[model samples]
Target: MANIEQSASAFLQSRRSVPAKMLGLPVPDRAALMPLLTAGLRVPDHGKLEPWRLLVLEKAAMTRLAALAVTRAGELGLDAEKAVKGSAQFETGNLAVVVISSPKPSDKIPLSEQVYSAGAVCLSLLNAALAAGWGANWLSGWPSHDREFLARGLGLHDTETVAGIIHIGTAQNSPPDRPRPDVAARVEWVSA
Candidate 1:
């Protein structure tokens, strides 16, 4: 790697969310996106059970998702504004990948582990996009949590839940860095 990090902390500190709206045109093609997806799949899996699956939503699919959100919101008797907001991410995205937490049957491997693996995949996808010189954001809205929306809109099974919608595109502007968490306040020194 040409720009290799000298430290682990530096590697993590470099990661940040680039506003999806600030992203420009010309998203990654299928061939380019495949490697990113593959990289995301390489996450921690207890018992070697890959519990996460992704749905790559392009421009056309985004329109469908937005349309579905509008219709489903009416069915659920939610506010029009909320409905529109929920779908806006999809409608405006250059490209998106839906990380689904597909918890499968496993008596030994805990369900929590499966859910975590899915979350890990979400982070992996987001980081991969940033590393590839693309702006990416992991997001979720009311539609993701709503049962009708997932079923009627995204066609997600009951066993599957949407973890996040990973938006990817070329960054239009430089992102302003935000405040970091107070690590000292959050940490506790454990001495035996």
Candidate 2:
């Protein structure tokens, strides 16, 4: 196989999301994170709206978010068990990047298109972290959907919302591969 083709194929085949709970410390520092962040920005954006923003949360911020999650859960009348589970990420996270879907006012581009750009940014960041030898997982729990949690914890504007919360750290263990979708069954070929 050609060098480029072989490497790309191998990487795509081996890519997997390590569980956030299984991830440990030693996450990328600001100096080390620049390249990865740059790579993440290489995504499709119609109208150049760039309808997204990244919020990096280190240990202190993570701790604060976790506490806030629990408090917000109670105020929302969420079940105790679920509330605790939702707050676990904030308490345990070594590092995280919250992708905020901050859609812009665009007459040409639809709102859905702007939202998809944000989603793409999330995936791009996740992939960049994984490629840089970090254990990365894209996650969204009850707190992400809570308006009070987002506003109070992250200072997100009313127009902005969580697209994804990407957790990054060292890998404690490699999870076994799960079943994949049957592409052949899902695909349809069109003929003129």
Candidate 3:
């Protein structure tokens, strides 16, 4: 087999999240986005229950969501500055994938596990976009948590919730590296 480990390790080591605000167009066309979506579906799925769904928000959809954010913000009694910040992402982005965690009814698999699977899907989608030379950021602002926004904006069911909103587009500028967690301090070796 080819030496895939080296390339994978290098890619993981160099990977960084580009902020959504720093991302610009042209967003990946369906042809390019398909492979990323395929990769996202390849994550660890216990019981083979894909407890997640992706909603691609293009220009018009984003605009509608942005408008909803503004109205919802007012209804939620948020201040102007915070409301603007909440909707700014939708107002600007060319494309974004909203990962919805939709847990399925199961006896063998617990709901927590299903939730984790959804989270894994989010990370996988983000990484897939990054690996494909697109700037990707996983974000969830106040609007994502607002029930009114969820219902009116995205039509998310009560059992379903936003796992992440992954913005993917061309990067406006390269960001400087931020500090990483000290793994040694946080890790513990145990043998029993």
Best by TM-score: 3
| lDDT for residue 118 in candidate 3, whole number 0-100 | 85
After aligning candidate 1 to the native by TM-score, how far in Å is the CA of 83 from where it should be? Answer: 1.6
Candidate 2 local lDDT, 40-60, one digit each (tens): 778899999989999999999
Whole-model Cα lDDT per candidate?
A: 0.88, 0.90, 0.92
lDDT score, candidate 1: 0.88
Model 3, 1-192: lDDT tens per residue?
A: 356888878899889999999999899999999999889878788999899999999999999999989998898899999999999999998899999999999999999999898889889999999999999999999999988799889999999999999999999999678999898999999998
For every model shown, what is its TM-score relative to the native structure?
A: 0.93, 0.96, 0.97
lDDT per residue (tens digit) for residues 1-192 in model 1? 445645435657878888877876889999989989999999999998888889998899888988888888888888979988987887888799999999989999999999999999999989888888788889999989998888877789999999998999988889888999999999999998
Clashes of each: 0, 0, 0
Candidate ranking (lDDT, best to worst): 3, 2, 1
All candidates in order of TM-score, best leading: 3, 2, 1
Which residue pairs does candidate 3 place in steric collision?
A: none
Better of 1 and 3 by lDDT: 3
